[model samples]
Structures are given as C-alpha cells and as structure tokens.
Target chain A: MAHALTIHNLKAQIQDKPILNGINLEINSGEIHALMGPNGSGKSTLANVLMGSPEYTVTGGQITLDVQNLLEMQIHERAQAGIFLAFQYPVEIPGVTVGKFLKRALETKISGMNVSDYLKDLRTTMDFLEMDQDFINRYVNDGFSGGEKKRMEILQMLMLKPRFAILDETDSGLDIDALKIVARGVNRARGSGFGALIITHYQRLLDHIRPDFVHIMYNGKIITSGGEELVRQLEEKGYDWIKKEYNLIEEEAHEYSTN
Target chain B: MDDKGIVNTNKKSVLFDYQLNKTPKSSWSADIRKAAFQSYTQLSWPTPTDEQWRRTDITQVDIPGYNPFAIDGAHEIDVPDSVHALSLDNIMMRDTALFQSTAVPLIRKRVETATDIFEVYNLSFFNAGYFIYIPENATIQNEITIRYNFLGTHALASPHTIIIAGKNSSTDITIEHSINNNNVYIHGLTVFLHENAQCRVNIVQNISKASYFFSTGKVSLSSNAVLEYFEAHTGGSIAKTMLDAALDGSGSDAWLRGIYFGTGSQHFDLGTIQHHNANNAHSRSYYKGAASGTARTVYQGLIEVAEHAKKTDAYLTNKNLILGNTARSDSIPSLKIRNNDVRCSHGSTTGKLNKNQLFYLMSRGLSEKESEQILVQAFFEDVFSHVSGGTADKLRKIIREKISDV
Candidate 1:
C-alpha cells in the first residue's frame, strides 16, 4: 500500500508471443527486494516491459510509481519519474562517450544538475566505482569487457540516483571485486528514498546486498515468496524442487526449448 | 558584364559559336584548346546507358543557349607571389609543341583513367580554367584559398584547375566551391605531386540547392611524395564527385577523408579510387555521410593494387546514416587486387540510426531529435578527428547546424 513502485497483473509479450503471464510485484522506498528465477522465466521480459522497451508489448498490466501511471508514459518518462533499469546487456553506442551520456542525463528535467557540479560529482562517483576517470571519455560501453559493461551500468545508476531501480542480472559477468563494488554502490544508495528490485539467478550476490524480501519465479509466474528464507530454500533444494512442489505442468511444452 | 553572361540567342549548337569567339592566347594554348574542343565534339553528352552515368542523368542539362564563360568579374583569381598563375605563360607558350610547352611541368600527369563522359567533357570544353605552378622547393606557409562564385542561371561553367607541386616542394591548397544561383557546372582538377613533394588539399563543396554539379579530380604522386586530401560536401541539389589518387612512386603515401550531409531531396553520387602502382605505397580513405528527408546518397570506392605492387597497404571504409524513411543511402566498397602480396580491405554500412542506441540515449533524458543529432555528430567523429583542430571544429559547427535544419 505504501510502495514507491507497484506492479499488478503485469502481462506482456514480445513479438506477439506472451512472456509475462501475470507479474505482480511491489517495492517500498528505502527497501531492497530480490527476484530470483531460472533462465528464460520471463524475468528479463518483466524488466524490459516495465522500462517501456519498444520490443515488448504489455497486454494487461498496471505499473505505477508513487501513484503516477507508468504504462502510459514514454520510455524516458519512466526514468524521469524516478524509475531506472540497469540493463542485463547494455547496448554499445559508438561515438557517445560515458561522460556525455551522464552529462545529458544529469542535465535532464529530473536531476537539473549544472556542468561544473555535475562533472565534480561524476568524478567522485567514478572514483567510488573504481573506474578510471579516462573511462568517462571512452564510448558508452563500446569495446568494454563484460565486467566493465556491468560496472558502467552501475555507474549510471549511481549518477541517476533513481527512486526505484530494477537491476537485471548486474552480477552475471562480474568478478568478485566488481561484484563487491556494485553491491557497495547499491548499499550506499539504499536509504535515500531509493528502492530496488535486484534480479539474479544465483544467491552469491545476495551475500553482498542483503535482500529484505526474496521471490521465486517459475515460468513467468511467481510460485513462492518469503523473506530471505526463500533464497536459502532455493539455493539448497535447486529449482527442480520448487517446480515439482508447485506441480507446474509444462505450459505448452516443446520438444526443444528455443530459449 | 551583363547579369546574363554570353547568352547565345542561336540555340542551335552554341558550342561551335562559343569556341569560335574565345580565342586562345598562343598557338600552343590554341592547339590544346582546339584538340580538347574537337574531342568534346566527337563525344556527345553521356546518356543513362553508360555504366558510371546509370545512377545520374545529366542529359537534361542544356549546355547550349547559356553562357560558356564565367560572367565578367566572376573568375577574378588573386594568386599570391608563391603561386604562379599560368594564364600569362600559357599565352606565351602557344607556339610550343604539346610536350615542349613551357607549361608541360604545370599540366596533367596521369590522365583521368576512369574517363567518364563528364571528365572528357571538362577537358575538352573548359571555358574558364587556370593552371597553378608551385615552384620547386618553394614552401608556402599559408594555404592559398580559391572560392568560386558561379553566378547566373542556366549558365554553363566548366573550369579546369591544374596544381603542379614541384620536386622537393611543400604547399597547401584549399578550394571552396560555391554558387550564387542555379546553374549547370562541370569542374575538373589535375594535381601532380612530384618526387619529394608534399601537399594538402582541402575541398569544400556547398553549391546552391537548385544547381547541378559534376566534379572530378586526378592526383598523381611520384616517389616519396606525400599527399593528404580532405573533402566535405554539405550543399547541392545534385552532385557527383570522383577523386582518383595514384601512388606511382614507392614510399609515397596518400590519405583521403570525406564527409557529406544530404537532405531535402538532395542527390549525392560520390566515388573514389586508390591506385597502387609501386611497392611499399600506402593509402587510407574513409568517407561518412548522413541523409535525411527524401535525400539519396550513393558512394562507390575502389582500391586497385597492381600485379607487382607488393608490400602495399590500403584501407577503405564508407558509413552512412539515414534519418528518415524516405532517406536512402547505398555504399559500395570494392577492391581490384591483382597482387597476392598486398594488404587491402574495404567495409561499408548503410542504415538508419540504431534503435538500441536511440533507446539508450533517450533513457538518459535527451529528446529523440537531440539524441539523433548527437549520434550523427559522433558518427563523423573519427573522420573529423583526422582533420586539423580549426577545420574540424568548423565542420562540427556546420554539421550541427545542418542536422538541426534537417
């Protein structure tokens, strides 16, 4: 009821193929939530659909931030409304530098930061992320390694300073040091009107950023939800137990999974 | 000079009457002009059937009934002391043989090999032209700038320019092409960089939107000659430009960079050729362009390596960005490599802006158009980076304004 971000009956599809059957989730300000799931369980689909990616079609859903209708706004409108999604695969933009991207973003309607102050803050943020100051001059994610791309995503998140953020597998390709650095940024942004839905498969990331609540999603549906215990259960028993315990019949089973 | 220059009321073959009226300074220059005019008469204007002319149709250009020579005050060329404008000497060399003409060193070296119909036309009937002689071992610190202001509609202006950089000499030439009104113009250039010669030529073409333009360039580099050429095509309704650079001497190097932005039904046909004839020669050419509105751009480039030109290095790339549905771009990068012991590669990409890139930028607060402008500027970043600081900044400002206009 008192959530900064809320989603109800979120049904979405890509290329007319329904992926998110009905995703219901909520995140309160200053709280961190973890959505754990197997690969291709509509986790990324929900993230993209929420961020208003043009590739996906939201058939039926209501996504709101502090009572503002999100589904009706444009892709950037959602960002200006304090919603940020750290992409699982950040697009590489040749010729656009990280500094330019951050500068433009900070100067947008939301942040309204000026040039000198923005640059100073950017340098401080860059230093905190353990990124070279020269990295800001390089093209946005162009020629960046997997770990560097993820770190760049986190760097943007720190600068944007959104109210509610959805991080899609930000830990997938990071080393231990990078993982710690990213989690530290998240932890630092935790209490300042910031809430996040951290999407990941393994619980190793949970070791760094302690999730207030844990969710188990299977086949576009969240089958179980609990506090921290769900992560321990899923980690120890694996996903097969959840599938069998819930008796989730194969929804249109195929001979070979395309995904 | 009448605002309407040399208006031939007799529409039936103004070519004959025009040639008869303009007398050559010397029998030698007369012979060259007469031979060129004869060649022009033998070869009529190119039809659409020609391979090179297939994409562009210039038969609609009515060359007759219009002025052949530039109006009275339009072709006033002011040359510095370091530059020897050959108009006077050409008059003095009229009696000399073709090869023995005192201007031999100031004339063409490698004839236009890809002789399209237009190059031949320019060579034959060039009414307004000049030959520039950069004295041997003469180093001119400041670049000489020549800006052509072709005035009058339906006017026929064919200008031929020959820049001869003598042995062991270094110079820079910047030619800016501009037109006062709509006209049909054919321009040609023959540049020879002799042994140990170094030259940098910057060509800026921003002709009027209602005009038709055909331009060709032939540059030959002798052993140890270094040539750097940069061209930017920003204005014109219809334009076709071809530049051919030949590395005839070993240790010679050539670098070519070009940028073009077309919009509002504009048509650009750009082509380039890098010919390697000697061993250890190097050449790199890159061209980038942006098309919006109903504009269409066609780019074709070739890198030719001779059979014995081993150890040659060549690289070519063409990139185009389309801004709207009606905008179209075609890039053709081909190689004619006869030598097995050479390094040559070509690449091209023609497409609209990337959706992912667009989304990525918009997510950070830039409007759709602002994001596109930024990306388009960034698209030409590599090419501009090769240019001088001042020239690059000037181009950046111009491109930014043009992008906003489109």
Candidate 2:
C-alpha cells in the first residue's frame, strides 16, 4: 500500500507569530504538487511543520501519512516515517564530514545497503550533482558555497529516498546547470511510492520538474489552486494580481461581516 | 615542618619512608630532592579557597590509603636500538657512560621545585621515572616507548620522566600511565629540546576511574628546536594536569594538542601556559574536551609574551562540549602580552552540540544519542588531526567506547 500525506485545516505558528492558518493540502503517493507562494506566505513554514520541526508549533490541525498520525511522532520519527525536507538554507556542521553523516542517515533510512554498494551509490549521486567525490569527506555544509549547499540538500534527498519530500526553495540559489541536476535527482526519485511538494516563488523550477497540481498561497492560506496554467499566470503577473484578488476577497468578507 | 606534614598521616609516612630509603642515594639528586622536600614540607596543602586550586578540591583525596614503590624494572619496556632509554634511578644506581654524556646536567636542572605545591610534591616523592637521551644529530626511526603500570595495593604512585633531545637530533617518544588497581596516580614529565632538535611527545594517561590522577610537566626549547606535544587523557575519576612550556630559544616552535573525554562523576582540570621568552618564536595550543553524565571539566590556557620577545606568534584555543544537563564545562583562556610587536590571541568556548546540527542528523534518521555521538566525535576531530600514527585511531576508539557509556 502506498502512502499519501493529508493535511487538514493545518494551523501553525513560530514564537507566537502565526505562519500557517487553515492550510489544507493533500498529495497522493505518485503525484507531484507545486506550492507557489510569495515571500513570507507560509510556504517554508508548511514544509518545516510537516517535518515536525520543534521551532514550529502546530496550534490546530491534523496531519497524517496514510493511517499514521504524523503529529504524534518526534522530529526524527517523522523522518523515519518517510518525511523529508530540503532546506532552503542548509546548516553547516563542523567536524562532521558529509560522507559519515549521510552514511549514518542511510543506515537508518535504508538499513539493508551494505558498505560497498552504498559507497558506489554515493559516488554516483555526487557525480550526478557535479560535486567532487572528495566532498563526501568534507564537513557537512561547512564553508560550502550557496550552490553547493543547495545541491547537497538534493543529494541528501536522493540518498534518503523518502516517501514524501518537501523541497523548500531548493531551486532558488542554483544556477541552470545545478538546477538541472537537482531536477534530475527529483525526476529519478519520482513515481511509484514517492511524492513531493515543491515550494518555490518562481516557475523556473516548475519548467524543469512539472507539477501535477499548482497552488497559490497568500496571507497564510491557499487562496487559489489549479494546474500548469496557474504557474504561468502567476509568473506573468508577478504576484501583484494575486495580491489584488486576495485583497478584493478580504474586502468582500469585511463588508459582509459589517452588514 | 617535615614531622608536621608527614607525622599526622603516619601510614602515608611509612609508605613515603619505604620509598625514600629504597631510592639508591646520589648526592646530586639527593640535594635536589632535599630542597624539594623542604619546600613540600613548608607549603601546606592547597584548599578550594585558593584561586588556582579553587576548581580542584582535595578534601576527599586520601594519601594514606595507597602505597608507592618501584613499578618498573630492567627490560620492563623494550628500548629501541637507536635511542638511549633508561630509568633515572638506574642511572643514579650506576654511573653509566650515557649518564655522563646526557643525564648528568639535565637531571640537575629539570626536577627542581616549582611554584605549585603539587609540583613540589612531584619533585620530592616521585617513586619511579625514566630518562631518554637522543644523541646529537642522530635520528631514531622507532619511537622510544615507556610505561608505568600501577599494580598491587599502592596508595600513591608518582612516576617521572625527563626527555632530552640533543642538538640536531630527532625522535618520537610515548609515555603512557596506566593502572590495574585503585590508587592515587601522579606522574611528572620534563622535556628539554636543544638547538636544532625536533621531537614529538605523545602522552596517554588512562587510569581506572576509581583513582585520582595528576600530571605536571614543563618543556623548554632551545634555539631552532621544534617540539610537538600531544596529550590524550580519557580515564580517571578525578584528573588534573598542568603543562607549562617555555619557548626559550630564538626561532623555536612548539605545538601542543590536548584532547580529553570525561564521563561519570569525573572532575578534570587541565591547564597550560605558553611562555614566549625569545624573539621570533612560535607556539600554539589547541585543547578540545567533552564531558557528559554528571562530569565536570575546567580548562585554563594562557599565552604570555615576555617584554623582550619581539615578533613572537602564539595562539591558544580551548573548545569543550557538554553533553547532558548535569554535565558542565568552564573554559578560561587568557593572554598577557608585554611586547607590542608580538601576535598573541586566545579563545575559549563551552557549548553543547548544536541543536540545529542535531536536528539535521536526526532528520537523516539518526537517534538523538547517535546524532550526539557523531557530533561529539566531530567536535574532537580538530585535535585528533594533530595526533599521528595509531594514536589518533586509538583515541577515536576510546572516544566511541566512552560515548557508548555517556
């Protein structure tokens, strides 16, 4: 049985500041969704909340992966349950080399891979990401350039092979060459039992990895959702039109409340 | 004062007397010992009220409960062909050609009384010790190794070592202190590097956690000499060590890397002083430590540049990782620079494993403990890289073992 992530009326906040208000989304095991939003419109918050980041407190909502309650598990438990987040700003861990950290992670995520085969696969992924094989021996994201950090995030996703991955602006800092490799990593890992919620502010990434569904997020909620056309409309209008439309909706609600 | 110091602890005096009577008398060392003993007798035991000994309290430490004697004999450790390695007592027992060539002058100047009381005790009652002499312009390919193993019911064991590298000579030396039974452990070391000499000292101290361990040492470098000192301390219930180094020779260089792993209720106090005495000398000290389980650690490092020492470069860094809520680490790194032309900097930081780093590892599916263990190992890797041979690997193995119990 394949897994499907269902988030119902999700509400979350960080430091008592509300980020996600009544966010409802679902992605089947084989579907890819593009979550396009303006800056500070709760896209990153949703991804972080889905991974059970301790910084984000879920004020109200129910999140489930198939029949398992995702909210009931700890952060690592959420990872073990197959939830992955590709951070926009990856952290640097001094003294911990990339190869060792990934090996430990893979051992827990996919325990059956032996050392020799794992090394081979890791080499392949490094090669695909246009990274030097020596990088696997370097400290995790320690002193890495912006592009390298983003590529490393995608490389981790490829290694973990999670059932669902939320890529939060992973395509922002990447050049076209690096962006293709990241898209290629996602493309190869797609379908079967894998799904992804690709969150971004631009349609450039959607051009590489097309989403089955598209969503427009504003004011901590998804005000509109559609297919490929939605991405083009937003990219052409540059979010100003969406802001105007959401403003009209807010004005209508306010007037109705007053009457 | 002697009676006042030893008479109250008669059991300790009997052990000390047996040790004193057994040491074959040599006028040179006897005079040195007599002076040191006088200082030791006059100086009262330091209490927690005193600033230097404030972090290290000896109220619970008992001297009479243990014994001390000759713990090493002839051929107890194999001596490589290219180096002269023998006990100081043995040299005092029989005046050897090597003694005349190397030991006579260094022994006279090495183990005299210092300012500290415990070091004064080391100068007075070191039960056993070794002296290794590397001949001038000679290179010893094999590392000269020595061990002082405490066995039987010894209440106190103080083994000392003095290493002198002759001019233009090069060698590696490893001095390890270990114990199979419970006792108070104290070892002393004095290293002398002559002009153009190059030497590396690897000191590994791993006593049973049931004992209290203390080590005090001083190293002096001559002109154009280079000394690399590494100390890896892992065991002992309560451990304290002070390493004072003087870069006395112009163009001399010194590198000190100290790494320790403390767990349980252990209290570890590690201190170092880099004294820049000559112009154009370079010295660096990097100390990394971790404490978990109710353990506490204190690290005090100082880099002092004398007034006449111009163009000297000295650096000191102390990094400590505390694992649990009950575990604590205090790092105090200071500098006293008297020369304006010198470059000296010191920094100390005590922190836990980064929570974000922990989450990054945990997000990769590692348990919290596993994440912490990896980060802890990573935390010490900076210092481990300074260690060479199988010693770094050995330290890594011990760290893993300790982490399993942390």
Which one wins on TM-score? 2
Per-model TM values vs. the true structure: 0.86, 0.92
DockQ of each: 0.50, 0.67
RMSD of 1: 4.3
**lDDT for residue B30 in candidate 1, whole number 0-100:** 50
lDDT of 1 by residue, A69-154 (tens): 99998877788777888999999887778888788887775455678888898899989989999998999999999988988888
Looking at model 1 chain A, report the run of 10 residues with the lowest lDDT sum.
A249-258
Clashing pairs in 1: B26-B94, B27-B94, B28-B94
RMSD of each: 4.3, 4.0
Query: Residue B220 lDDT in model 2?
Result: 92
Runs of candidate 1 exceeding 4 Å displacement: A1-3, A110-113, A250-258, B1-35, B65-104, B108-117, B120-151, B156-161, B166-173, B305-315, B332-345
Please state the Cα-based DockQ of model 2 relative to the true two-chain complex.
0.67
